[model samples]
Target: MLRLRRPNASLVLRALLVVVLAATSAAANEAEKAPPDLARGARLYSDNCGRCHNARGPAEYSDAHWPLIVTHMRVIAGLPGEQARTIEAFLRASNNPPPPPRRLGRLAAVVPAAGLSGSELIERYGCRGCHVIGDAGGSIGPSLRGLFERRQADWIRVQIQTPREHNAKTLMPLYGLSDAETSAILEALRAAR
Candidate 1:
């Protein structure tokens, strides 16, 4: 009978350690790779979440909380795994986006306009799709220029919140504008030349 020498215990242990180290190094490298596509995530978020709720900026939530929140929302919104992951990646990336580029002759950071700006509110509700505001806006409805001169502030507010109340034949849709949004729109219209 031929006798076989037993394997060396130290050699076996060293081999195991090398394998472990290699695995760890590979995992670290994977972790350091570029993050997922944030633009895709933003689109996913807007298409799904923005339908019912305001599409809040990603910086609203912390990195740790985003995964959990998005995971929960995924089920409620019936989102697929890939879409949820993409949105989570976008939220993580946007949580701390780079600062805006510096502009020449720009005034030192003035206080931002309170609440959503008028232009933002208009765009958000697709007001330009039906009404002409300035040089370039929609013409389906009456021009928004000199609206304040024609309509009272209260009338504008009422029309925005309840369009049909003012005109039975009005094609304008009610946006259920918040008080802040209403105020901002009014301010913007008033400031328009």
Candidate 2:
């Protein structure tokens, strides 16, 4: 009579296999966990605005200009407040990122706000489709040369926040921005010249 015998497998080998499998599963579980707000913002930015908007530093534009540009992006990009906030955080983190602290100078670094420059915002939002900035840009909109010198900051802020409020025939659309964005855009415009 021939008896069937199971192939010999070491207990240690089986234990190792089980441990490896458990570790892999744990790693996967961690990845599946919810992303932080900044991560969400970065994902949202890549999906919605990264196509046109390039990266920049906080000093690229004044702290005053970040919000206005974001306002326009919020509308044109169709992002929700949570997503917008996340993107804003991501922008601030990337652009106006913190400077390494000085242990001796005791001088605080002036950092730009957490968002894109007005120029970047304009480019990303397709303002270039109509308006022109510096020597290059689009032709569909008005030329934005020395706009800060031509217009008062408050007036410029108002016009940007609500274009229709100033000119009924103006084709520029209202972006409904926060004060911070308006300030940033205006500051950027001031520096553009």
Positional deviation of residue 103's Cα in model 2 after best superposition, in angstroms: 34
Over 1-193, each residue of candidate 2 has an lDDT whose tens digit, in order, gives: 9999875578778888999999878865664474434434444555556556643333454446766777788888677755666566555543432453233222212223565776666554444444556665544356888787677777887787767689765645444555555665667666677
Reference-based TM-score of each model: 0.41, 0.40
Candidate 1 deviant stretches above 4 angstroms: 1-115
Q: Pick the candidate with the highest TM-score.
A: 1
RMSD of each: 13.2, 13.5
Per-residue CA lDDT of candidate 1, range 52-130, in tens? 7866645567778898999999889898866787778766765643443343233223322554577776655556545
Model 1 Cα RMSD, 1 decimal: 13.2
